[model samples]
Target: MASIHIPTLMLALLSGFAMLGVQLWAAQRSRLRYLDLAVWTWGSWTLLAGFAMLTARVVVPVWVSALLGNGLIALGIVFYNEAIHRHVLGRALPRWMWWSAPTVAWALTAWMLTWPLAVRTSAISLVFALLLCPAILVLLGPGWRGESSLRAVGLTLVAAAASLLLRSVHALTNPEEYRDLMQSSLGQGLTFLFSFICLIGAGFGFVLANFERIARRMEEMASTDGLTGCLNRMTADALLRHELERGRREGTPLAFVLLDLDHFKDVNDCHGHHAGDDALRAFAAEVRARLRASDVVGRWGGEEFGLVLPATDGPGAARLVEQIREAVATLRLCDGDGHDFTLTVSAGIAVAEPGGQLTADQLFMRADRALYRAKDGGRNNVQLHDSGWELGMESPAA
Candidate 1:
């Protein structure tokens, strides 16, 4: 039986810790709790400390290595379990369980110090396996279903736990053949090697998961309005064009509703620009609440918004826009001094001509004309686009 290479295992633990530490710092600086990267970082550090002390057994007393070193390793496993429970299970592990598990692990390990070498080895292995059980169950549980990354991480942890369990089983079944851990049989050597490899693999899997989340958030921020949390102008334009093409092909009606806040300049003058910003957000929220989920709204520009409503005619769009206008009229906004004031919105509706060759730009122009009519007639009403309404005519139809 070949002896387990203690130095080699310690070096692997050290290297893994170094890499994970750098990644933890990067995650911290980014202000992202995207994954359980912070928890994993702490686990790695504790595991590194345990392995370092064990490797220096000559300088560190035997009892210290047997008690404190093993306790640190157990704490590291508990941390890893917590990370899995939170990120993979999508829920937090109980606080009592987190503290109690480590207390029990340390107490049991210390008590076993007086036992025979083989008994101590078996006890330690069993304790570590028990420590990993919670994380393993969560990974295989229903919460983790359909997640490939979680499955990969779960499988690696399972293998590491199995290795520990097998080492314990081997020690108990073949007590005569059991030797010192650093000078042991094939089973002991494989256990250490597999555990080291699994730890490194889990670290990489967690880091990759966080990076994927960051990428998704970046894409969303780019396409969404930062202030109103609605679709931005560019994203809205593209989506509206796509909906227009689909409606044209399917012979369904599509309508574009353009809304402009009436006398927005007055609000900014009375209160501060901060109040004006609050008014804009309040208006967008009311529009969203009054419309259906399928209705798409975007911040067209300052004091203006646009909506693309599928399968709707001019009258239908006008009714929806009218509801939103009434809702906005009821909205009360607060100024810096806590005074409240109501605001009104003007809307223009342009329904797509079924099976016509009209482009999105032409649709927008017609809607803009209707919006001008609404502004001209009275600054707080909805206007549907009239075919006879001319863009440059002074008295456009309302």
Candidate 2:
């Protein structure tokens, strides 16, 4: 068997880990604050330190090389596992879990110092395999099913665990072939090579995963209103057009509603724009609470919102809007001066019945006209538009 240069592989791995650690540190500093990236950066540096100690086992004290080195490596794996847990589930493991694996591995390695080289190697390899198992489970779990980068990291962990397991079994069954840590052997060489590959794969996978998260967040921010947490005007318009097309194809009823807060300018003038913002946010929340998940609500510019209701008729849409109006009236808000106040909303609804050929503009115009009627009838009321040019009775203002 061709002897693999163990020292040379260790040096290369140390260098690789150092570079990966630096990149991760830079990413954590420059990009969005991700808890997982910070944890992984620490893990990379910890692993680098452990590898450095292991590489110098020839000159270092046996206790330092065997106990501290192995302990750090196990701790580093724990950090990696914790990072995966935080990234996927958005929570950290228990405090005890952070120290349990490293403590146990350190104690066991210390006790096994008097044992043969093969026995010590087998024991440590098993410890590494155990340390990596949780990370594998987290990355490959059902929660992250469609994340390809996470899956890649998961697969790399699986391979690393399998390699560690193989090394453990190989050392135990073929003790004479693994006499020394620095000796050139096929088993040691393959194990180290696999470790190196796993490090590179896992690091790259994490970076890609962070990028994916950032991109998704950017898309959401672009489509969402910053203050009210509703869909922005442009996204709402696009959604209305798409729903209109779908409703026409399926012959389903669709309702478009225009809602505006009554006397909104007075609130801003009386309580300042900050209070006005609070009212808008509260109104949006109440409206969202009363809406179905399939319903679409968007901030249609200042103090005005648009709703797209699928499979809703004229009467159903009116009832839902009335409920939203009552809910808004019950909201007790305080201004900057600690003065209590309430708000009312006026809504106008236009329904397109099945098989109707109403264009988006025409539907919007009808709804807009109905809204003006509601405002004119009273400050707070619900009005519906029908094909016969009939309007629903206005609800009394609270």
Candidate 3:
């Protein structure tokens, strides 16, 4: 096997990590100010510091290089694991978990000072492997199974862990060959090479993961109402058109409902805008809870919401709307001044039977007209289009 200069490899890794750390720091300062990115940046820099200390092992005191150097390396791995955990699960790891492995690794490194050099090396390698395990579990967890970037990050961590474990075993079996830290042995070369590659892969993988998260958030912001967390008007219109076409092709019925909160302006005027906003969010949640997975709901405008129910007939739509109205009536809300209040919703339902030739606009208009009738018929009622001006069953005042 060929010899590889360990010092040169360390230098290369040091420079690479420094650059990666700087780039990540810059990204965190940019529009992508994610907590994970900040944590990853710190991890890279810590790794850089550890590598720098290790590279200067020939000049620094033995304890500094072996104890502080290895300790920093283990700490850096912990940071990386924490960053992945936060990014994948949107939460921090336990405090004990954060400090436990690194502290043990550092203490073990000190305890092995008088032991064989290879044994010390093996202990540190195992520590690195231990630190990476949690990140791998989090990245491959079921919650993020569909995220390709996270999968890539997880696989990279797997490779790094495998390499570390292999190094630990090799050091134990070939202590003579791993006697010195700066030796020109193939094992040392391969270990550092693996470290270099894994470093680059992990850094890029984290960046990709951050981008994926940002993209998903942007898409959500575009498609959903920020206040109510319901589909926005434009997205709702597009979905309605698509669902209508699907219903026509499949010979299925579809229902469109327009709902408005009764006296919503009075809620704002009497309580405040904050109270009004709370009521809107509560009404949206109630409607969403009553809907099937296949149903779609959107915020049409202030105090108004739209619902699209596929494969639903007039009676089914009317029943669901009535249920939503009753649910709204039961919501106990409070104003900024701690005064309690209640709310009511009026809904208008328009159903398109199988093979009906109703355009999206026409269907929306019919639902809108029905909604107005519900509002005009003394409020807090459900009205169905084509039901011959029959006033819907009016619920008592909230």
Candidate 4:
């Protein structure tokens, strides 16, 4: 039996485990947690099983290490597909194709452990390497949008597999010289470097992401209303201007909704300012829940709020704002004593064509006109800034 290279194995194991950690972190981003976590979990399991295969010296045939390593490698690929399904691939592996990856693992494991490992048996290892090639292509496939981390991962895996394949060929071509302590370690060290060292560097992407997420969240808070948890007038207007440019360039539909809490001063006058604050908070929460994820909501200041809905037409904008209006009416916020008071908000919606001539200021002016109409007509309704209504209204246009 070949003795394990203690240092090389230790290094490989550590790097592999570190990569497993990153995989776990990356996996958490998936809306479906288990599907992604399974990849990292299986990867760690493969490493553990590989270690066990190395340590249990007396348990199996001479080539048992190769079989165990290859089997776990194949299992890792199966889970790799799962990760790709949720993350890099942007689609789920089909039921049949998904199951086949596993079926491949099970069958390949049996073959590796039992086969005599003559040149004929080594064919199985070749098959696993081939699978990585296609998996690499899909996992990191090229994009019109340019390169991605998945593509980088695909490149790394492809090169690593190539190194492994070459080393295998080298060993087969010259078995005697490749069988020594120094020789074995050198071959394995190169393989380990190929398989994992480049990826260890890539792990920094996770750290970068973590820091970026933290910074983004902090920036969001700085520009947001603490009580309502929406962007403040300053921030929202800044964002709207940016989006207005995008709307013009992309030729996509955009809508603006300007809203105000009706009789908000009276809520403060009647129930106290604390109640008004609660209403604002409740209003923000309701608006947030009602808007599509693509929609942006912000506190326009002093019981006034605003939204920008991209890729939505006028009708869609109206329906959504009306839904928000109705939802705000039904939402019962409480005072400190836990008394429920139903609140109603008025909304004004304005939409523009893609690359529309309207500036952000123009859009806000239109929406504000609609909002004023809603207020004048009686609150708790959504009004659109049709041709006649657009000329007059308050603007939080910034």
Candidate 5:
């Protein structure tokens, strides 16, 4: 077998470093998804350092080469897993997990420093495979929530882990033939090749995932209100029409709630437009907090918000809007001067009966008419278009 030279591994390490730079540049140029970029960049550095240390194994003490090289490579695996979790789950992993995994793996590497070279290498391979478990768990847990690139990331990692396990078992079974892994050996060459392939595959997968996320976020921003973080009028109007069609076709009830802040202009006049924006944000927060996940809330127009609740009847939507109205009353907003004040909302609810062929505008107009009645009867109340005065429940405190 031709001996695997140190310069060859150095070239691979250099390649990884170059890719990391390219990924960093792409991240900045696009101005999106720095988390994956940062995580994978660390992974590249760890692998590069590990390979550099491995190349010096001939000059260094056996224990130092084994400990540092194996420890760093294991750490690279852990970080790749962390990147997967971040992109897929949109959350930070527990501090103990990524923080302590490499430490613990390094401890294991240290303990195995005195063992036979083949045995130690095999044991470390097993540790590397185990370190990949976190990423595997995330990828396999549930659906990707519409991001399909996550599946590729997960599968690529799974293949890498399987390859590691196979090498571990092979080394353990034939210790005599694979005793010196640092030398030009077929086993070592294969391991290095697999590591390089995994680095390329998973790295590209991460880039693709981040790009997909950026596109989706851009779409969201386009369709969303900047201040309130709710759907904008255009998107809300389109959604109402879509839901109306579905309710008509599938025989499901759909309700729309139109909400206006009582005396919103007064707050603006007294506290400035900034305070008005704050109140609008506060109102949107209450709407989000009190509504069901299936319910869609949006900024319909100036000082007016709309809600689309699928599978909801008139009374059910009434209770939801009433709860939202109460929640709004409790919201406290601070003006530029740091003084806090509360706001109340007037809500009007209209329901499209199952199998009804009402248009989006029809539903909107009905809810809007009820809103005028709530304004006329007095503010801080929920009025239903279908039930008229009977369902015109005014807040006792109002």
Candidate 6:
């Protein structure tokens, strides 16, 4: 209960500010400067503000300081959560979640108002701690894709918790000592708050850095395919829709092409499974080599590929797929046998009509049907679709 040390609190405030400055300086140098950078930068500044609040706590009574400290901590957590949601959560938090801030504030106000002045302060901190338990567990929970910042947030909360526990334990043993300490200039409260700021401020700094790292990682995971390192099926569909919309809006044509490797199952059968994987990888590489910078290619599924050709019409897409097919046919997978193995791909292309309604699922389906028709007519051929047609072939397993 000893009063917070004014000089130490000032030092903590300045140190926290210095940490914020460093965090900002480093944030600017990072490659991806967006909401993530802003969140981390703001988090550092909040820690400094929280430190200032703790410093102000010493001049006020222990009960007042505790309330203020709790409020500041809650605000800091709110900012941290916002950073996570902006960078990590693909969606926004619901309005119901907005109540947590004022709830913590109310809890702090109640705690301060209910402090017993005549007798000793009970272990009331326990109740607030228990209240915060759910939030703390949320940060450390399995669902948190916010791996980088979660530990830092947890550490900050834990530091505040330790201070509370320390003060509570000390107060129960010696009431007079606790009162005298609260009255003194460097009583338990100042020591506790100062210690809390140093430990938790540093923790917040770590959390900010992690927020950036985790956000970047999340983006990579969302947009890039794990196996081939190209765009994933989800991203490919999204990109197709985006490009189609753009083309429609600008009165331009965008091409959709579907490609399927012929006799791919035989390749898996003739060689070991690992060799089939290598062949698929080699086929992807060969196909990629024939593509232009404006084209986007992604594996639609096992033995299937989806291509998006922005600004290209149906004929252009056919020519591109034909080039890819020819390039793939020329590729020879060599083995120890005297004869070399060859691979071929059949392709289908379609152009989006101006003012035509097309959904991604429907577009892919049309192109895919064309691809199967080409496969049925003859392997390694391009079938360009003018209208929807069924090939009557069974869909392959993904």
- In the range 244-346, model 6's lDDT, one tens digit per residue, is 9998898888889888999988887776566677778888888788778988988888888889999888777777788888889988785444345779988
Error of 1 at 293 (Å): 4.5
Global lDDT of model 1 = 0.80
RMSD of each: 3.9, 3.5, 3.2, 9.6, 5.5, 16.6
After superposing candidate 3, which stretches have Cα over 4 Å from the reference?
Answer: 97-99, 387-398
| Candidate 4 structure quality by residue, lDDT tens digits, 1-398 | 35346456655666566565656566656553444445545555565565455444346654565556555556655555555455444566565654565456446656545443333223543555565565566645542123344455566667756765765565566455344323344554455445544434333332333344455667878898888889888998988888778888888888888989888887887777899888888788888988787789988889999998888888888888878878887877777767667788888888878755888888889898788878888777888777644365443311
TM-score, predicted candidate 5 vs. hidden true structure? 0.73
Q: Write down the TM-score of every candidate.
A: 0.82, 0.86, 0.93, 0.50, 0.73, 0.46
Error of 2 at 7 (Å): 2.7
Q: Which parts of model 2 are misplaced by more than 4 Å?
A: 31-33, 142-146, 265-279, 332-341, 353-357, 387-398
* Poorest stretch of ten by lDDT in candidate 5: 389-398
- For candidate 2, the C-alpha RMSD (Å) to the true structure equals 3.5
Ranked candidates, highest TM-score first: 3, 2, 1, 5, 4, 6
Best by lDDT: 2
State each model's CA lDDT, in order: 0.80, 0.86, 0.86, 0.65, 0.78, 0.65
Who is ahead in TM-score, 3 or 4?
3
Give me candidate 1's TM-score against the actual structure: 0.82
Backbone clashes (count) for model 4? 0
Tens-digit per-residue lDDT, 1-398, candidate 5: 56566356666766765677476556745645477668876787787787767767779986787678777887777777777767677777677876577787678778877778778768778888888888888886752454688778778878888888877887878676576754556666676567557766877777777778788888989999999999999998899889888888889999998999998888998899998998888788878988788889999888999999998998889888888887788777889999888898888888999967677898998899888878988889998886443477543211
For model 4, give the 10-residue run with minimal summed lDDT: 201-210
Write model 2 residue lDDT over 1-398, tens digit each, in one string. 68788878887888889899999998999748788889998988888888888877888887789888888898888888888888888889768867888898899888998899899989999988988887887788852574568888888888888888988998999888678888888777887678656966798788788878888889989999999999999999899988999998988999999999999999999999999999999999999998898999999999999999998988889889999988998999999999988999998899888898888889999898788878998768888875556455444321
Question: What is the TM-score (0 to 1) of candidate 3?
Answer: 0.93
What tens digits encode model 1's per-residue C-alpha lDDT throughout 152-206?
A: 7878888888888887887788776455545545666676678667877877776
Count clashing pairs, candidate 3.
0
